[model samples]
Target: MPPSLLLQHAPCARPTAKRTASLFSAAVLASKDGGGARPPRPRPRGKPRFSRQSAIRKSFQQEQVVFSTPVSPDPTVAVIGGGASGLACASALAARGVRSVVFDTGMHGLGGRMATRAVDDERQLVFDHAAQFFTASDERFQKLVEEWVERGLVREWRGSIGELEAGGHFRPIHSSTPRYIGVNGMRPLADAMLPENDLIKVIRPSWISKLEPFNGLWRLFENEKPRGQYDAIVIAHNGKCANRLLSTSGLPQLTKQMKRLELSSVWALLAAFEGPFPIPHNNSYGTFEGAFVRGVDSLSWMANNTRKLFPFETDRPECWTFFSTASYGRRNKVPQENIPNATAEKVQREMLGGVELALGLSKGSLQLPFYTRVQLWGAALPMNTPGVPCIFDPQGRAGICGDWLTGSSIEAAVLSGISLGDHVADYFASCGERPEEFAIGLDDSLNRVEGHDIGQFPGLDSSQKPQVAEAQLTATI
Candidate 1:
């Protein structure tokens, strides 16, 4: 079947796998055998209430460039990190007939945390090691997610999202907010949103090692070579990397804000079993494609990727992804010392041990994972997110956007970009050599989402992330 063709038989996620898997009745049935109900936790507050609907048709006719050159009339915006925030910013700029170049460090593809990997032994088995699923709570995000759903780029995951309490017990928490995921994997969703347009250009495996201010423009140095000159620079990276670059930009306030910002680290582990699921679900917690554990030592989240995404019953191994709690990640995150499998051994054991205790699986009963991989995500999650939708310093000609600016989750990341784009657009137009008319530039139409108190300017709602473990990774720049 074409990867884009939707599956009509998947059990957990409403959308069928874009590349692998089929029906997951067996997995869902097994989970149903051990199900229980739990109460919902109250939501957190103090997030920037997001509300905006700006539309700008593509109008720029100039050719796209890999590295910025002298382009009259059109200004260049360099966006670091080709993840959700970066792409969203580029896309928004493209719609406004603006020019932008995206620089990414990932060799695999654009999506940073929305990543996927194949098990070494089994080519068919795959896992989304970083971001698992996302929810749409804002109107702007809801509209975009709807379009993605219609385009087959995204699907709804009706995983019985539940909370794991103390002592390995589980409880199901009901919610109207539907969680969505990329069809094949998370990366494809971000990739699909970015089209090969004249307004937006992309460069991969290009890491910006230094950021220097040249006169009124910004010059980027990638791999120790002078890359290009950009009229404006958007820090779309996770806080740590962005903070590092901003420190050299000579923007004291912005650099200080990003530097003081703290983030949570995460150790993501992907494992594949020999055959169909080797573990059974416990009835007390209920069956969930994604689940989170609270008060559990070192363990944070676990997912049945095959069942949650592809849902096929092939003799091939089933895949699962595990994440360590922020606390555990901080304690164990250390530089590699050239010893092969040293970091892998300890992380893998810690994850597996958490799984064993959570499932009550005896060492022998629970088969060992045939395939395993460990990824260190430092500054993975934002701890204290700023209440502003984005940071736009006109004097600095630099702006900041990410989940951290808005709130964790894909929705927040996208919203942050859009909001930042609006600010950049207004600033760009007002200072241009000749004023150009824009479709809508934050005039009433960009009013705050109803009931949100973001002070005169509209900002993202502090729509708190209710479930961190299964809901996905958190952060922004």
Candidate 2:
């Protein structure tokens, strides 16, 4: 994520309409209409050149990223982290006759940070606590999304978005590209990708603490105990987790590089109001799906989860997730689950204060949510990344893949997984040890993806424009 994720001003475009949305989840993606390509290079007189931090507002800034591995053979593989990257890797490998077992902490269920909170009470209400929607422009990902659309697993979110400025002014945001969300909730999208008794196996509520070697294969340990053995392991997770796991797995060089990829924290609060959604400061749109707020320290994002769902309803109780800025989260981070700097009620009031200010409501106008839950992500917004697509060690027969490989965003996550899986499959095929029914193929689009150990590769020709666009959307809250 960009260091200026929380610092986009009028001079810089935001992610939503180039309205920055790093606070929404661990990774952020910009819409086609949100932040477009740099307008024909040469600036308009006095306008400053958009900084890399500002470049992040653009969703696709394709880097010359490549995933290469010097590996031997693999049949049973272990994929850690059940997020977008991990699941996609497993799915690709499974289709190729490679068997993999996925392990995750599952704090947010099978989707990792892509989660939804199903509020329990007399009335059923759900809040998309993370990753409101994702954009698919790549051919392969577009094909994958098409299948999901056909199965009624996802739907387009066509509602108009707005940006909230420092003065509380709100304006309409128009975009050409469509934003898609899960049919029921984001979690269902991940749940639907699970294969039945084949190459993919899911182990949830599991924290993989370490990895060890026995004989020729790898032994995975959960909570400090040996869990299973596998021919290879994929570290599909954040940089911190990857570094720790690699450090213990006897890969010091890789661990040191991973440790350099830093990330910031965020606090996501899920709440459901009793009345209709809150009106904007100027009541501009009559209703809106979401807003990217600037000049507010307490809150950076606010979304009406119900409104984002297709067939927008005029009358529906508002349910939204508020994401706190890195500064705010760091200030209020609890030492323990029970021990806290402030009482629960006090924290709730402070969060509500940001909402009320954004909506131009008077004191206490925002009602207390009937259902409320707070979650702290120590590694929410990615700060710096390796941007190498994926990493592998043939001698160790292990590798790592995630959004961190190419900064943080949904697109990065998907591409990273696909690239890693391809290398793994190719490694097996080269060793003449892969299954005969292998279906994995590296065609034209993949050749466009090139990666290295250090320094950004310059392939800024017209052909690589889409990839550059894809890499441009990595900002934080």
Best by lDDT: 1
Q: Model 1 over residues 51-128: C-alpha lDDT tens digits?
A: 122111222221111112222234568888888888888777655545577899888888777687754452687788
Model 2: how far is 91 from its true place, Å? Answer: 1.2
Candidate 1: lDDT over CA atoms? Answer: 0.60
Cα misplacement distance, residue 212 of candidate 2 (Å): 0.7
Error of 1 at 236 (Å): 0.5
Error at 417, model 1, angstroms? 0.7
